[model samples]
Target: MNVAASGTALKRLRRSARLIVLAPGPRVLMFRYDIPGRDPFWVTAGGECEPGESFEQAARRELFEETGITAEPGEQIARTTPEFVTPEGEPVRADERYFIVRVDSPDIDTSRQTDLEQAWMNEHRWFALDELDDWHEALYPETLRSLIEEHTA
Candidate 1:
């Protein structure tokens, strides 16, 4: 556990890798998480890195686990600075690295999601770049729209 300058105990740092999965429509795939006690929010497909795993390795593994899409996680494109609690109730300061993966098809397979994921992640969708701005739900990273626009430009 880390400590803040104010002498408060801070959430443990969790290293994570995320992917921006772009489909044929130049749309991005996102999962809607309905975590208990919190409003639903959309997020990319990714997860925490296992011990000794590189960000790239974790990104690939998470992509398969979350969407069943196997692809190379190319150059990192964005990152997030936030402190949030996981569904399991663990508070964490996430060091999240983002990468881009382009898929030929938008088909997703949730068969591989863990029990926790299945319970919280009830829906998935591919949104066009412009659709993100008008999206009613909150998007993690907050800067996702601008990030996508910057990269896809």
Candidate 2:
């Protein structure tokens, strides 16, 4: 478990679970996000863990909540704890865990998004591995590409 909090002073810890959801085309799912003055970027789908929820459970719930996609969240492939200010300027400490799930192509459903997600997510795309190399500066969990390669290898 990891803890993350954002603010000038870090006090609160938020644990989150993320998914590296992949389709048959070997493409990875990502959300386009824009943070005010910052350039747009991409992120894997996920959200904070609810109280008393295990990481795996949170991963499953987050996937469904964010994309209306359902699948058994497989093994945890990576974990990181990072602290940053949210786009809303709230300081947050995030304990992020990444899980891998593979599925056939499916249409995404976003009607279930939380308000925060509705505001932050601008669009969604399935990215080819080579495309990721060009998106390094715009990818969250910056080590995402290497992590995927490492685990898949």
Of the candidates shown, which would achieve the greatest TM-score relative to the real structure? 1
Q: Estimate each model's TM-score.
A: 0.93, 0.87
lDDT of 1: 0.90
Give me the candidate number with maximum lDDT: 1
lDDT of 2 by residue, 1-153 (tens): 233364334446879999998886678899988767877778999988999999999999999999898889988989998887666776777889999888787579989997877887979989888888876548877887788888877
Say what the RMSD of model 1 is.
1.5
lDDT of 2: 0.84
Q: What are the per-residue Cα lDDT tens digits for candidate 1 across 1-153? A: 677899999788899998899987789999999987898999999999999999999999999999999889998888786888888899888999999899998789999999999999999999888888878999876788788778988
Candidate lDDT scores, in order, read 0.90, 0.84
Instruction: Extract clashing residue pairs from model 2.
Output: 4-93, 4-94, 5-92, 5-93, 6-91, 6-92, 6-93, 7-91
